[model samples]
Target: MSPEAPPDPLDFRPRVALASLSGEADADWARAGSEYAGAAFLGGIALDEPTREAARELVDRDRTEFLPADPVGFVDEQLAALADSPVQAGFNVRTTELEPLHEVGAVCRDRGAILEINAHCRQDEMCAAGAGEVLLRDADRLSELVAAAAETGATVSVKVRAEVPGVDLPAVARRIESAGGDAIHVDAMDSEPVVGDVAAAADLFVIANNEVRDERSVREYLEYGADAVSVGRPSDEPAVLDRVRDATEAWFAGEVEP
Candidate 1:
């Protein structure tokens, strides 16, 4: 008999996700914030040796980090913790090698979760280690990683940051689409219109991130063609989520003009 087909990658319920914030986004945090979100991406976990060392250094500097001895096992445990949650779960992971993506992607596939490749982090330690924003400049490598993760049959999303000098986000989005990526989680930073540029460039699901705190911010992103928006720093704030959720619902219901 043939193997079961993978589930649709962009099957989000409410069109809002709790973005992964390094060190802080975990099962418990997800459980607490799941009520107002359709999905939650847990952890910007470091998956390989070099990246782990970089994460350790970040920790030494008082920055939050998730450094698990057994990276794949930690991901499995985190996803397992959210098994009963109503919100769809995902992991935002960083690694310099393709092997770890395959390993972690397999776990995500088994657990029916999204495996988000981290190209958005700009931490000096991470970038110097060639695991984060370095991927942004190397679209070929990023696409290769996305392709590897896609092979696991789990939904794959690439978390990318905008306004990085010389990096063409729309071009990168097209590359991800060709590599079988299901979504583009764009940290729009100060350039909100880039979300629209990416959405127009590829058919992939576009998740706008950064500054998504209220109705105006939510509507702006939706109007710019974002399929959804993710809350980062303020993800744990019930009031903030409430506003974003209501705005999303209102926009979809046509109560608000674009």
Candidate 2:
């Protein structure tokens, strides 16, 4: 575990965020607009040619699209286009090594944005390459990855999958926090309570994900101790962002308190 600085409050903890949704390109960015989100994610962007090729091959089957251009340039371009975005911008990347990850982090640092490592990708190609959920199998290496990127002076977040076959999610979350990760985004699936449990076990800001379709689900995850909740499929609809806003404001106003 390495030391870390406190997270930026405006980074959107305990609020509604747009998760990294897959498309031909990063559509979430354009679609999100200035709608009412605390933050928006820009990938699942692959770092190397193999990972990129894997994602491209999986497109028809898994709908995973890696960044078509160089990752550093992609981040730069995305950040350039979002110079005036209202919400915090986070770039989600999938890579197995620290060098490329560091490069991407450097881009984030130079551009003044957040870099989120994608350990939550479940695609067969990603898993087969030991680049995604496989990181959960080795906490030390995962922590090292987090630590390495954090050293680049970039805000780092580790996104992991909950309910994995042999992965102890709470332990993973703690390790990420110890490694200086600023946030943990959990694809909690149907087990909402795990979000709270992870929050309790680790000091990192927890972002709950999975099946977040409506206001009810958003409120449920927040009540479960997640500092924030992310929506993917539901976020595709502009009206859904309104619902999330209503639900979040209501939560703060005590109308959605459980």
Q: Please report how far candidate 1 places residue 257 from its true position, in Å.
A: 2.8
Over 1-258, each residue of candidate 2 has an lDDT whose tens digit, in order, gives: 888955473356337777876553263463463477778777778887767777777785857475566777877787777767666777888777778888988888776777888888788887777678888988888999899889988888888888888888999998998898889999997677889889899888888888776788878888888877777766667777777777876887788648
Error of 2 at 188 (Å): 0.9
Model 1 agreement with the true structure over 116-220: per-residue lDDT tens digits:
999988999999999888898998898889999999888999999999999999999999999999999999999999999999999999999999999989999
Residue 145 displacement in candidate 1 (angstroms):
0.5
**Candidate 2 residue spans exceeding 4 A from truth:** 1-10, 24-33, 60-64
lDDT (0 to 1) per candidate = 0.92, 0.78
RMSD of model 2 against the true structure = 4.0
Q: Against the true structure, whose lDDT is highest? A: 1
- Residue pairs with colliding backbones in model 1 are none
Worst 10-residue stretch by lDDT in candidate 2? 24-33
